[model samples]
Each structure stands twice: as structure tokens, then as C-alpha cells.
Target chain A: MAEPRPAILIVEDEPEIRRFLRTAFGVEGYRVVESATGRRGSIDAGTHKPDLAIVDLALPDVDGIEVIRRIREWSPMPIIVLSARVQERSKIEALDAGANDYVTKPFGIGELLARVRAALRHAVRSPSGTSILRFGNTVVDLEKRTALRDEEEIRLTPIEFRLLAMLAKQLGMVVTHRHLLTVVWGPTHEKDTHYLRIYMKQLRDKLEIDPVRPRHLLTETGVGYRLVLDE
Target chain B: MVSIDKQRKPPAHPFSKIPAIFMGNLQRSWATVLRMNLKRHWVGYAWAVGAAAACTFVGLVMYPRFDLVNVAMVYLLAVVIIALRFSRGPAIAASVLFVAAFDFVFVPPRGTFTVDDIQYLLTFAIMLSVGLIISRLVKSVRRQAAAQAALEIEAETERIRSTLLASISHDLRTPLAVMAGASSSLAESGERLSAAERHALAKSVFDQAQEMSEHVAKVLQMTRLETGAIKVDRDWASLSEIVGAVLARLGERMAAHRVIVELPDDLPLVRVDATLIEQALGNLLENAAKHTPPATVVRVCAQRRGEEVIVTVQDYSAGLSDRDLERVFAKFHRGSVEGAGAGMGLGLAICRAIVRLHGGQTWAERVPGGGTAFRFTLPLEEAPSAPLELASN
Candidate 1:
């Protein structure tokens, strides 16, 4: 067990929230570096060079989006945002500003932990990610342009494959509608969310066991879509 | 000494009573302004003139067939009716106009303002007095009715305030008590308790905190909906997607009941704020889960009816009374069985408000086989054009 432990940087203004996060991350066998303001958070990101960073959007000195931008300028470290339920617009904005993921305020520590683990694992994986994705009995191979459900090949339109590939690229993290639409349907259709809705339903119908309560391809309500795969 | 103090209290110096003098003058000015406002009803004056003309015409016709005293009686009736219908200004105007017209047309002078009989002066005086007295009486009654209406509004405000306070103290205080007791126990006696016991206490604290947060969020959301702070960001969305998201959000809360969904495959895409619609549907599911007993079946169904889509959440429980069915959507209206963990009864109210903001209607009705159905409609819109992949591929 000579592997160096992963480090996490927490940028939050409230001392109470920071205290709990410290304890939670500590108990989970991760080293934590705390910053009380966004300015200090950006500085610490450059100094500590942590494997990942969890930043609160409501910072005292600067906007959390600013911190993410500064970090993006120099590092490709996984950045996850902590936002309140009221900050729905900024949550999407943070994602569009290069944030890898977000956890809403008043969230269970388990939910945050799962997100953190996924983001870190995604960072460690190949930059192109895995070509083959699996959801329950369904398997989709992006490179091969194939989808199978229970070993039977299911036909998917080219747009559906492209949408799946875009979601799979940010697998386990929220991919904003703007990001997916821009990448899959070109920049002209960035604001056309119905395309995503129609295609997502099509994908879910063909792949999911029960399309109504999907286990893998999930909708993020006003935010975006997240593609989760069984390990 | 007491007499001297009383004398001092009466303000020995004139300067000491300056504020009192000023207040009296201010009150008089306000009364004048109110009187000016009362006289601003020109329509009433017009009606008064019309009434006087009609009485004059009738009086002239009766000058040959009836007595002059009877014509004066007609003038008195016109004054009384005008006083009852309008303010003092119109009443006085009606009486004065009638007197001049009667003297000029029906009196000794056939077309002049000269009166030959002294008793005609008596008739004019009586008409003026009657007009003034009736207008004063009518004005006082109107003032009383306006005061009563204002008092009713104040009482309503007081009722809502008390209800809000009661709800906050009951719903929010319970969670506060649990969190305080549980956390204090863990802080003071963590070493003495077993691992499972400590875990249970911690979990209760967490669950209570979550419940408290939800209650607070609902209160805030209701206020935001009422204050016009919520902007409905409409987009092309599917009812099936919104329904699925709500079920997943209410995962464990609805787990106790046997939930069934019946949505048609060809359901059209609706243009609405998806997140708000999700919350609206979630509240219905939560209400159904809260009222019904465990293991009862709850059905979520949707159908396209004409230009709108009707979504229903039906629960197979003891149906609500006719009164409760209507009152359920009113703010702070609770059901008969308010078990522990019951909300402040704002879920349905919030649901109704959100649905209305989306140009939809919500209602509750009893199902035939002994259950309640909560239904709402979302107006449909023309579907957007889907992208073609042929040329791009």
C-alpha cells in the first residue's frame, strides 16, 4: 500500500460546512486542504495541486465560477461545485464554465462522496474514456456504433449514437443541454432542448429495462443529463 | 400638589399647546379634502338634474289636472330618492333645481322665478330640509359599511398570521426538538452508547434535519410563487420524463405504497417549465403517499384530452369528504388524519398555484370505488421540429 493518497481542496466560506467536509473527507482516507475564500482557494489550487477540488458557489471574496476559470487556465484537475437549491442557473453556469460536477447544498455526504469518487475515477481514466458502455443488460460500443440489449442488437439512429457518445464522454457527470446539443447537433441547435428530450427518450426506451424509471441514463430536471454505467 | 400638577398638565403656557393646535388644524384640513373628494362625482349631479327635469315635466302636466301641493309632493319624492342613491351634493342640487323649476312653471308665475303664494315658500323649505337630512343619514350608513369591510380585511390578515405562526411552531419546532435532543445526547454521551445506538441517533438527526429543510423550502417556495418571484422558464418537455423524474425524486417516500403508472406512448410534448412541473407532480404524489395507508395502490395516469393533457394521481384510500375535497387546495387546510410528519398542508396549495401559473387547472374528486383523484391539466402546444440526421450523416 505505497500509493499516495488523493488530495481534495475545499473552498467554502462557512466554517461549519468546512468543518464537516473536513471530517467527512478525512474519515474517507483523503487528505484535505481548506480555503475560506475564493481568492485563497485559487491560490491553494495552484499551491497544493490537489487531485480534485470542491468549491462552494457563494464565496466571500470572489465568485466560485471565477475560481474554476482560474484553475482551468492552468490545470485540468476535476472541479466539483457545491451549490444551493436556489442557484439552479449558476449550477448550469458552473458546468458550462468547465466544472466537472456539482452537488446541491443540504446534500447527503454519501451523495457527495459518490460524485467525488466518480469524478476522480473519470480523471484517472483514458482521456477518450471507454469506448464500450454498459447499463444493466444493455451494452453500447461507441467506436463500433452498436447497441445490444440482452445480447440482441438494437438499432439506434445516428443522432442517438452521437448523443450517447457525447453523454458518455462526461460519463457520471452532468452534461449540460447546451454542451450536448452543441457537440452532437452543431452550435446552431444549442438551445434546442427538445432534441435531447426526444433522443433521450428514444435511447432510454431501447436500452433501459424500464424506461419510466431508468437506472442509467438519467434526467437532471432543469439542469442536464447524466449517463451512469454499471461498473 | 395634585391640583398644581393638574394645572400644569393643562399647559399653562400657550407655546406648550402648539402641537395640539397644529394637530387640530391638520384634522380639519383632512376633513376638507375628504369633502372635496365626495363632491367629485359629476355623474351623480347629472342624474340629479335629469330627475329634476322629469319632475318638472310631470308637474307641468299636473298643473291643470292636479293640485299644486301634489306637485310639491312629487318634488319631495325625487329629492328623497336622489339622497338615497347618491351623496349630499346631488341631493341638495336636486332639491334646489326642483324648487326653481316648480316656482317658474307651476306656481302663480307660469314661466318666471316669482312666487305669489307664501305657502310655496314653505314647500321649498321642506324640500331642502328633507334632502339634507336624508343625505346625511345615507352618508353615515355608507361610512359604517365601509368601516365594516375594512375590519373584516384586518381580521382576515390576523387569521393568516396566527395560522402561519402556529404552523411554524408545530412543524418546525418538532424537528428542532429532535435534532437538539439527539445531537446533545451524542455530544454528551457518545462514549457510553453502543455503535448501533449512536448510529440510530445520528440518522434520526439527519432525517429530522432533512424534513425541516423541506418544510422551510416549501414555505419559501409558496411565498415565492405568491410574490411573483418565480419565472416560469418554459421549454418543450415530455410528461413521461417529468413523471419519471418525480418518481425517482420521491424514491423512498413513495416506496411504502404500491405505485402504478399509466402513461400513453403517444403523449405529446408540453411546453412548460419542466422543473416546476416536476415539483407540482411530486407534491401530488407526496400528498397521496401521506394520506393513504401503507400497501394501498397509488396510480399515476395521464391522458390527452383535446388541447390539454390531464394528469391524475389517484390513491385507493378512504375518500375525502366533499368539503375536504374542495378545501384541500386552500393554504393551511389540513386533512382529518394529521399523523406525525404531516406537513403544514401547503403541498396542494403550492401545486395549485404552480399549475395555475402554467395556465392549468387543478381539482380533487372522489373516485368511484372509494378513493380520491387529484388531477391537473397542462395545455399542449405545437411540437418543435426534430433534427434530421440524413444530410449530416
Candidate 2:
């Protein structure tokens, strides 16, 4: 039996962007469903039940967030948000509303595809609930709360270990500062994001081949942290 | 001041020697002085009449117990009161009325306008002069106070205007300089550079242009906000959607900081202008990113408290000082964070303006744990029963 090509739903208001996305996805050998308005997108999402959905925050008929919410109400499909450069708050809102990832407009084809791949990969692999995660030469044992580089034990402080564990739990998916802080420190310390940074640096120093330009413990700048299993 | 003085000088033209021009200037100044005096004197006369009547009543009451000189002193007290309350004109009027009232009421033949003793004339003369002197003194003091207030207002306006200009120029120049340098390099040595280097140069030029355009848009948005040109298009909007949009827009730039969003699922939808609230949140996030060190956590959290949704962006950087916290949202007020990049300092101001336009209040405070937190409250009242379709038809 032949495996069916994965389907992707792109909900963008702009025709030119829709065309660009369509062409890009076509080249990547994936079947794409396109909707020019948020209303149509939401309807298409429900009917098609695509493997994944890419939504724009600003839509002409219905908001992209509304589309995300409607789909999220019933579907657990991975959702990637497409937004303009100044729509940070909406991007986070989309993520908190069960979006798997986002790529800003004026984005490179390579970067967009990478995010799409990572999101789809997370969706496919997250179900198995892998206890151990490996990236580059490093192995993170989620069960034992320890990490090793090339089979040699890497020393990590309690805070660093918890940070790594949190990142490991959502391998290849971005974990927000609030999520990391609350999970590691407590709910009261959600705003203590600097603690996450310092510990993240320590974890990267121990686990990454080069802490200066970490491949695994990746930063999403103003957004959050993502642990990439295979850079 | 120099320019004002120069403007006040007679025109350095051959026409200035004309008699008609000279007469015109003279007449204008005279008219101004006369108009001012007329306005002042009307109030002065009213005060004078009131004071005279009061003094006459007091004289009648105290004539039996107090001597003529002591009763005259009461009129002196009236003159002082008038002098302090009114300016030069009223005080002079009070002085004249005091002497006349004193003579008419209690001077010689009680209740008649006669002076029997010549020594009483000395009393009237001395009192009149003293009253006039007090009027002059009080008038000068009043003038000084008014002048001081005007000067302070002018100084504050000038300071803010100058700061705004400085910030605008600096913000505009940095991108312009980058564009110029990068383009010149590309133009001058097109053949010598590798494809990667040339691409980098071109990218720099494009990035600078993008930044300049964004800056210009921000300035325009701020001006529109200040001029009350943007109307609040209140609609029921999802809070999570707004936050998500901002994070998506910030994309790569936000990669340096861990952005923690804590918008609860049960949070009620807020009635607001979606675009404006989105912009306000974006500005706050941008401010946090710029002021805080790279890789620091930026937390954007929202909660429903009472009838408002409080959204806060907290940065784990050195907290703002008391003074900075007070003035951070002021137009063109850049904080003391060294090397904080060339920002026009309009982001926070725009945030404040947008929030205020939505009938919400935006403020910044130091976090209990060592950081700065910027919070804004949007009224959570009037949530539409059905989800609002904010898309334009």
C-alpha cells in the first residue's frame, strides 16, 4: 500500500502570499488546501481535516485566531501561524491557543519549511512519548534527569537539569519562558525568565558541542526556547 | 529669546523711516495698553466700591468706642486687603475710596464730609500714600508670580520639543547612514566581493530601509494618536490572539529572549480595537526587548481581575529607577540604559496613547524580583454574546 501525501491547509488573506505558499509547498511534495479568508479557512479546516494548518493572524473575513480556536476545539493537528513582523502579541496568542509554531512574513522559504518540518515531526513523534531524546552528540535521559555527551556523563546543577528536562519533554517544540519557569521554579516564579536563561546557558554549555552557537538548546529570541533534536 | 528680540526690533527696511509706519506702531502699542487698563480698571472699581461700603459700616459701628485715628486705620486695613487681592489698579482705587470714606463717615462732624482739624488732613495724606505704595508692591509680586508660571511652562515645552527632535534625528540618521554605507560599498566594489558578502551588504541596506520605514510609521501613528485622528474601533477580541500575533510578528528578534505567555484559557474576551491593542502590546514587547539584555526572559501575562484584563510584559533586566518609571511613557523620554540603540522613544508613548484611547490605563513598575514590568488594563465589560467577526466587509 502506498502512503498518502500529507495535507496542509494554508489560511492567508493575501493572494500573493497564498500563491507563494502554494508554490513553496508544491515544491516540497505536500498536498495543500488553500483558503483566502478566515471563514472559508475555518470551514475548509473542518471539512478537509488536513494533516496540518497554517493560519494568518490578520484575515479578511474571520480572524486567523478564531480559525485556530475553532479547529483547536476538536482537532489536535499541528498548527503553524503566519504573521507580519509587528504582530508579536497575536503570535503568542496563537501559540497559547494550541498553535504548534509560527513563521513571520517576509520569511525565507528555507526557514518556513524548517519550522513546518519541525512542527510536523513533533506532531508525529510526540505521541510515542519518547523517554530519551538525542541531539547531535548529546543524549538526554528524561527518566533519569541526566544528560550525556558521547556516552560521558555531563554535570548539571538542579536548576539546569530541570530546564533541560522541560526542554526535553517538548523536543523540537518551543517551550515558553512562563512554561519553563512555572514547571521548574513554580507558578509564582513565572516571570523569572532570567533564571531560565542562566540555566539554559549552563545546560547548553554542558550538552552542546559549542555553547556559543548552540544547535540543540536553540533560542526563539523574544518568543521562547526550543530544543532541536537534530540540527 | 534672541529671535524674539530681533522680531521686536523695527524692520530694517527703508519703509521703517516713513511717518505712517512709525505712527501705526505707536497707535498699536497705545491701544494694547489702553485695552489692558480698561479691563483691569473695571474689576478694580467693583472691588473699590465693595471695600468702601464695608469700611463705612465698620466706622459707624466703632465710632463711639474707637477714636477717629483708630477708625481711619480700619480703612487702611481695607486698602491693604484690596491691594493684596487685586493688582495695581484696584489697589489705587481702594486707597482713594478709603480716604474719602474715612472723611465722610468718622472724620470731624460725624457722618458728614467735613474735616475740622488740619491734623486729620495729615492722617488722610499719610494713609493714602502708604496704601498706594502697598498696591504697587502687591502688583509687582503678582506680576512676578504670573511671569514665573509662564516661564516654567515655556521651559518645559521647549525641553520636551528639543528632546523629541534630538531623538527623531538620531533614529532617522542611523538607518540612513547604514543604507548609505552599504549601498556605496556595493556600488564601488561590485566585482571584488564574494556573492555572500554582496548579499550581506544588500541585506543590510534592505534591513535599514525596513527599520526606517517602521520608525516613520511609528512616528506617524504617534502623531495621529496625539491629534486624535484614530478612532477606537471597539470589537470583541481574543486576548490570546493578540498575544500570539505580537509574538509571531516579533519572530527572529524575539528569539534572543524567552517569551513566556500566561494568558489563561478561561480569560474573557475584551472589547477593544484589535489593531490598536495589538500595536500597544507590540510596542511594550519591543521596549522590553530593546532595554533588556539579549537572552533574558520576557514574560507576557494576562489575567482577568474584576472587570478588566490586565496584560503585563515583564523583563528580567535592571529595573527602571523611580524617575524613569514616572517619565518612561513621556514623549521622547529615553531611559538611562546605555547603548540602548537609536530609538525615538515613541514606542512607550504610543503604547500609552493607544491604551488611553481605549479607555484603558498603561503603567510601568519595577517587579518585586529585580526587573521592569509594563502593564496595561483593558476594560473587560460588554463581551459580545457571540464572538465578534472583526474582519472588515
Candidate 3:
């Protein structure tokens, strides 16, 4: 008997984005169903019973958070939201309405995949979800506060790991400047997005090739940051 | 200063101002003036006939006591009435009639149409000339006084509006800015909580505060815009740099839409007030966000066309109708029914005033597909005023 492949449903308004998510998730060996509007997207979630859903917070007729809430009335699947408004309010609403994490637009393929994986892990764990994640030659064990790169232990400060875990939990999605700052450096650090400029360089140097042009850590200029998990 | 009131200035013609402004217990129009003149003609003609009959009766009776004093008084009354009621053409005719009456009944030959005394002839000519001068003076002074009063009223009203706006500025903006800053800080502090708790706290504080801030900005901008007293220091600045500054300043707003910058890197510099242009662009971008759907692309681009650098901000939202495109730049003329209510419409109006101050132009048009494009221009770089020395020097 074969193991069931965790299905990821993508809800987006643009054809380019829907196609992008469908192809990306399909390549990763997860069954992917794409819907172009919030209503159909929410319906697909209920009917398909996807293990995880990637939702765009901006839709033509409805806000993605409302869709997340309606589905959450019944299903407990983890939802990862994509948004252009990197403002904190929208992100919080999507999550509180049952989305597992949030991503800002113009994201990398790998960052989205990682978020999908992390969200699935979160769905499996339910509330108070925390987990271990591995990508490329690195391993992150959030429960133990440790990380290893290629079997060699890589040191991560409590704050650095908190930032890493923040990205890890929203893997395959964009983690906005305010969100990362709020999670690691506290609210005072929200507008201090320049702080991310300094810390992100640290994360890439520790985990990527040619840290100057990082693959796993990407910047969505004027939006936020995305963590791509593909090697 | 722009008056907060909407009263328009009456036209330059004094006749136009007379109806509304006349210490006017009278609703006077040109037609009314004409009607009154026609109505007075019947009484005037009867009085003239009566006076002619009275002079002939005294002459025919040969009353020696009826001297020049009695004849002069009767003729003078006719001159005054014609000058006041009828026009210049009619007044001259009345003067002629006065001279005939004196010559026939009191000049010399009693009841005869002949001037018997040379002394009486000079007296009659002198009275006619004086009557003409008096009529002309009355006409000129009335028109001049009407115009002078209208100008005084406009100036006085402007002074009052400026004083009121100045006082409102200090009272309104200071408190609004303080509340906005404090609310944002509260929202940002939602960190260090469990995932659910953190999200909840951030949503409430950030959203309510944002709404209040948008409203405050519109009121402040309007009050400031109305003054026409923005002190903008202009110099040679690059369009690319201006766009970058505008985008950077609208950090919060740009977060909601995909803003694509398509300005060429090598575009020429333009003489402009960098701060004001940035502020204007900030308003335009904010306007776009309010109208355009979330995630629809908003673009800012610039190019040198015919010695002018054209800068345009285009949004892929519902385009405006013909009426909206026409008055989009008008003061406080907001897109009321077409879009969701946000801030008061002062954005494009500010943009227009800014561009015109630069001695350039601004306009808007509906894009073919489904969006509104706001386009404006700045003059291309002029030869540097400083004496240019060769680099070899």
C-alpha cells in the first residue's frame, strides 16, 4: 500500500499565480487543485478536503480571510495566505480565521513550498503546533532550539532561531517585515524592517550558497521576505 | 486665500452687479430700467404741455409781473426730470425745449417764436450746457461706485476665510497626528504573544488607526491647499529620484498594491519642488489604492516628450466616466458614487496646483481597458544658470 500524498489546494485570483502554484506543488508530488476566486476556492477546500490550502488574501469578490473563516467553521485544515497588503491587520485576520500562516506576493517557488509543508505539519499538530524541518543540507529542530547544516552543528542564537522558526513555520510563503520583527525583536522592531536587512544576510550566510545572492531567503521589495525551501 | 464659501464674483460689468448689490430695495435689471423710463414719459410729456400753456397764458394776458425768474424755474424742473429718468439722447431734446419756451414766452417777443433780445439768447445757451454736464456726471459716478463696492466685498470675505482656516489648522491637525502615532505604537506591540493572540491584537489597533489617519491627512491637505501659500523651493531634480522618494514615503500604502516603477534610469532632471512633488505623488498613490481593487497593478512612469518630462500614474481599476475625467482635478470634486468613500478628494487637485506652480500641466484620462490614468508633466532640464566651465579648467 502506498502512502497518501498530502494534497495542497491553491486559491488565487490571477491565472499566472494559480498556474505557478499548481505546477510548483505538482512538481513537489502533492496533488494540487487551483481556484481563481475566493468562492470556488473555498468550495474546493470543503469538497476536496485538502490537507493544506494556499490562499491569496486579495480576491475580486471576497476577502480571503472570510473564506478561511467559512471553511474553518467545519474543516480544521491549515491555510497559508498570500497577500499584497503586508500590513499586520490582514495577516492577523487570515490566521485568526484559521489560516496557518501568511505570505506577501511576488514570492519565490521554493518559499511557498516550504510554507505549505510547515502549514501541513501545523495542521497535523493542531493548536500550539511546533515542528522540526529539513531543507537542503540543513536541519532545524524548533522544539530543541538547534540547527545543523550538513551533519555539522550550526549555532543559532535564541533570537536568530526565533526568526528562523518564524520563517520555518510559514515556509513556502512570504513572512512580512512587520511579522518577523514582531515575532523576534518585539513590536518596537516592526518598522525597523532594516533590521531584517541585517538579520536576513545572517540567515543566508549561515545556510545558503553565495549569501550575497541568496536562494532560500528572498526579498519581495516593498513587500516582505519569503523563505524558499527547495535546494 | 481661497474662501471656504462658494459665492462667485459677479461679472466685471457694473450693470450685472446692480441687481444684487443695489442698496437695492429695487430689483433693477436693464429691462426694469427701460420700463421705468417708458412709464415716466407720459407724466413728463403732460408736465411739459402744462408748462407751455402756463407761459403762453401769462404772456397773452400781458402780466408785467411775470418776469424771467418764473420762466427759468419752470424750464429748470423739466431739465432735471429728463436728466434723471431718460438717457443722454432724451436729455438733449429736453434742453432744446427749454430754450424754445424762454424765447417764445419770456425772451422778448411775448408769445412769439422769435428771440427779440440778444442777451436772452446767451442765457438760454448757458443753461443748456450746464444741464448736459450734470447728466453725464450722474451716469459715470453711478457705474464707478457700483464696481468699487463689489471689489471691496470680495477682498473683505477673503480676509475672513484666511483667518478662520489658520485657526482651524492648529486646532485640528495637532490632535489628529498625536492620536495616530499613539495608536500605531499600540498595534505594533502585539508581538511576543501566542500566534492567535498576537494576530488578534495587531488587526484591531492597526486598522482603526489607519482609518483615522487617512481622514486627518485629507483635512490637513485641504486646509493647506486652500491657502495657496505653500512655500515650495524648487531646483533641478531627477524624475527617477522623485518617484523613488514618493514610493518610499508611501511605505504603508504601497504595501497594499503592486507598484511597478517604469521610469527610465537616464531620464533628464526637471526643475521642481522635490518635497511638494513627493507629497503630490503620495496623494496620487493613496488615491489609487482607495479606488483600485487590492493587488491590481498601479504604475508610475516618466518620459521626456517634446522638451517636457511626462510622468503618469496608472491603475488597473474601474476607469472613470467622461464627467469624472473632466472634473477630476477640480477642488474637492471627489468620485462620490463610482468608488468607495475614503479621504476627501484633494489629491489630484493638489497635483494640479503643484504642476501649474512648476509652470507645467496635469490631466487625467480613462485607460481603454478598465482603469484611470493620471498624467502630469514637468519641463525638461534647462541649461544650468551657473557659468559652466570646461572640466579641463
Candidate 4:
């Protein structure tokens, strides 16, 4: 039997952007639900029950963050934010407000499609996330709290293990500094961003082939860190 | 005073920053003038009265030993000193005060407001005229300085406007023209072209659009940096992470160059706006890749020296000439080699601005082995103490 096509809800004010997005998503064999305003977007989110939502941060009717909040209130659907380069602060705000991923404006459709696919795949995966995260030759089993490279076992500090597990929970998506710090080091250490910098380097040095130019443990610049795992 | 003709003929591109240099001097002079005048406005009158009283005491003592003319000359000296040291108001007040005191205390009539000698009347006129003339000269000099500053700012604004217009027409118009032509052809006669030709046309449209978007972004970013609109959101950040992010962002752009990153494992974290630093580093790398030949090595390295971390991006290409090295960081300065790359020549300028905002310095030098090295220094701070954790391995 053919599987039901996944639906994608796009909340954007510009009809031209919507038209291109609709065409791109349509050509990719996904059902697209369009909303011209934030109010209608929140309404469509409940009615359509899409597998993913692409929300433009700057909307005409209401703030896009409000739409993300509204959808997150009732649904666990993956939401990808479309932000302009100028909206750096608000982009991070949207991501922290439960957005799964983001693609900056003037971005090619292929970038957006990859983010959408990652967010959608992340949605259908296990709630506890993949226990075994693999990148390059390094394999980390979060459930067992063991890291191995090739056939050799690698020692990971307790904080390193916890940081890996926190990043693993949001696999393939950006985990904000505040989120990672809060989860791994507790709420009191949320603002201690130096801890994240220190630990992320250690993690990268241990797992990445070239720690300076990491291929999997990615830094999203000002936003946070993203851990990409091999399928 | 500034002439209207200078406004019509804006300075050339080479001297574009002359106005900024002029503005620095203007600001410093204004600051010094303001600091001197801050407490001198209302207090100058008191100083005028005080000087007159002090001269009156000297005149009273001199009247008993010398001729009354010597006492009159002493009052005249007070007026000359006041005129030299103060504004017109204080100078005029000092002149009138000295004249009244001389007439009351020393002129034939002792301790009364009367002038018994007409020659002393000439002395009063001379004192008043000196005060007015000196103050007028001082005021003119100040006004001239102010007018000169305003003229420089106006000429600079005109220069920037023209340069911006010229850059827009040259950099943005090319890609826009290609995009318009290609898209129209695809729309008007898609079925007439072969599959590969159609794909190539569409791909060119996409590529041109992307290129134009980058140009527009650089223009906007330069504008924002110039206007002081971008605020640095600083936090503790790792330089390696920043470099990693830049390399990733410039993946395809740097693919032609053999990129090498040499950061130490124990490199301390820097407090900076990581996003801006990433852009700054990315621009430098992109510039190196754009100017250097393919397969040449481009190295990115950072070393801690004293309290600063010096980051260098070295490209093994033909080095810039001495003059080119000096002007490479200027806006709209393209590489000397033609057809090497196409950019609005704002990458290094923007990189300099971003680095400067973080209290860092950026410069380019000729590498020893026929290449250029673009280096910047970022000041380092003591790393924040992290919470101690057990290994529990």
C-alpha cells in the first residue's frame, strides 16, 4: 500500500514566496497547506495536522513566534523557521520557542528541503531519540553511555556523556546553548556559555576526524550547536 | 568659509576617507574648545571684575610714586590682557570696568566718577576697540573651522552617494541583466531548447540570482556596519568553532583552494559576537580563495600572543604590490589582477569594521614566499570558571 503523503503548512505573507514554496513542495510529493497570516496559520495548523510547518518569522498579521507558540501549545509537529539574515535575534527566539530548524532567507530551495526533511524525519523518530548516534567512525550509545571508535572504546567524561546525550535528544536539529546548558548542567548553569564552548570542543576533539573543521558536530554560529548523525 | 564649488566637485575615490580623518580632527578640536568653555560662560564676567579690582589696587599704589599716566597705562594693560584671553562679552566688560575705575580712583578727581583729562578718553576708546577687534578675529577663526568641518562632511556624503550608485549599477546590474535575459528566454521559448540547454539556462538564472543576492547582502551589511546599526551580541565563544562554522559556510567557495586550519587544542575561548566573527573570518577566507589560484594552499591559524589572539589567513598566491597592500582594506578596492574574481570589494572592509568593533586590529602583509597574509588580533580575557565535574568513567 502507498503511504499517505506528508503535509507541510507554510505560514508566510508574501504570495510570491508562497507560490514558489507550494510549487517546490508539490513537486516533492508533499501536500502543502498555505496560510497568508499568523491567525490563519494557527487555525490551519490544527485543521491540517501537517507533519511539518515552515513559518516565516516576519508575518503581516501577527508575530511568527506567536504562531509557533500557538501550534506548539497543542501539537508536537516539527516547525522550521524561515528567517531573513537581518532577523538574527528573532530567529534564535523562534528556535528557542520550539522551532526544530531554520533556513535563512535568500536560501536556495534545496537548503529548505533538506531542513524540512530533517525536521520531518526527526518528528517520526523515537521519542527518546536514536540511542546509537554515528558520525564518521565514532559510535556513541546514549542508552549505554558508551562511545566507541572502530573497534576501540573511548573514554568520555561524565559531563561529555551528558552533553552528548542532550545533543542526541535533538538529533539533526540545532540545540540552543541555553537548552543544552540547562539540560546538561542544570538550570543554574544556563547562562554559563563557556561551559558549552569547553565541552563542545572536547566532544568534537574526541569524535570528529578534524576537530577544527568538524563535519558532524556543527556550530550554528551564534545560535547553538547541531549534531548530525549518520543514518 | 566653505565654498559651494567644493560641494559640486566631491573628492575622488582615493581620498574618500579624507573627510573621516578631517572629522576626527574636528571632533578633537571641538572637544577641547567645549571643555575650555564649559565653566567660562558665566564666570568670565566675574574674572573681568576681578581683574579690574586687582588693577585698581596696583593703580592706587602706583599713583603715590609715579605719574598718573602710568596708572592709566596699567588699566590699559588689563584691557589688553582681557581681550586676548576671553570672549567679546568679557573683553568689553573688562574694558568698561577698567575705564570706570581709572576715572573714579585715579583721574584728577579722587574716588569719584569723573574724567578730568580728555587724553584718558582716548585711552578708553583704544581699550574698547582692541577688545572688539580681537574678539571679532577670534570669532572668525572659530567660524572658519566650523565651516570647514561642515564642508568636509557634505563632500563625504556626496562621495558616498555617488560611489554607492556606481557600485549598484556595476555590481548588481550585471547579475540582474543575466537573470532577466535568461528567465525571459526560458519563459518565451522553453520547448525550442534542448534538455541540457534548458537546464543550463535555468541553472544560470539560479546562479545569477544567488550571486546578486550575495551582492545585495554585502551592500546592506556594509551599510549597516557604516551606520552603526549592528550591535555586537558578545558571549564566550570558541575560535575553532567559529573557524569550523566559517569553513562550513564557505564549503563550495573554498573547494578550489587547499584549505588548512591550524588551531591548537587548548586554545582559549574568546568573548565575541560569534555570528559576526564567523562572517568576518568567512569573508577573509572567501577573499583569499577568490584572489588566489586554484590548488594553492590557504592557511588559517591562530596563536596567543600576550593578551591577544592573533588570527591569520595566509594565501600562497602572487602577493599584492606595496600600494595595493596599503589600499586593500579600502571600500570598493578590487584585486589588481583582472578576472581573478568578481566582488564589490567590500569583504575586507567589512571584516575590518567587525574586528574593530571587537577591539581588534586587522592588517594585510606580504608573506615571505610570494603571497599575502591577512591578519587580525582579538584581545583575550580570562575565561569564566566552569563548574567542576567528576569523570565518572
| DockQ of each two-chain model | 0.52, 0.02, 0.01, 0.69
- How close to the true structure is residue B234 of candidate 4, measured as C-alpha lDDT? 91
lDDT of 2 at B244: 63
Which sequence of candidate numbers ranks them by TM-score, best first? 4, 1, 2, 3
| Sort by lDDT, top down from the best | 1, 4, 2, 3
Docking class of 1: medium
**What is candidate 2's CA lDDT for residue A32?**
96
lDDT of 4 by residue, B1-393 (tens): 123434766656757657666766786897776566645665777788999999999988887899987887887777777766778778888889988888888877777887677787897798788878887788788889999999999999999788878878888888889988998999999999999989899999988887788788888999999999999999999999899899898888899899988997778899999989988899999899888889999999999999999999999878999888988888878867756255878899999999999999999999886899999999999988766863333
* Consecutive 10-residue window with the lowest summed lDDT within model 2 chain B: B384-393
Candidate 2's TM-score: 0.54
Task: Give each model a TM-score.
Answer: 0.87, 0.54, 0.39, 0.88
Clashing pairs in 3: A110-A228, A111-A172, A111-A227, A111-A228, A112-A172, A113-A172, A114-A171, A114-A172, A115-A171, A115-A172
**Quick one: best TM-score, which candidate?**
4
The weakest ten consecutive residues by lDDT in model 1 chain B span: B1-10
Instruction: Report the lDDT of model 3 for residue A210.
Output: 45
Candidate 1 per-residue lDDT over residues B1-393, each given as its tens digit:
444554669877877677766666786887785567556967778888999899988887887899889999999999999999988888988899999988888888678888887889999999999999999999999999999999999999899879988998999999999999999999999889999999999999998988888898899999899999999999888888888889988898899999999999989899999989999999999999998899999999999999999999999878999889999999999887777867898999999999999999999999998999999999998887776763454
Rank by DockQ, descending?
4, 1, 2, 3
Candidate 4 recovers a fraction of native contacts equal to 0.95
Q: All candidates' lDDT scores? A: 0.90, 0.79, 0.68, 0.87
Q: Give every prediction's interface RMSD.
A: 1.9, 15.5, 14.6, 1.6
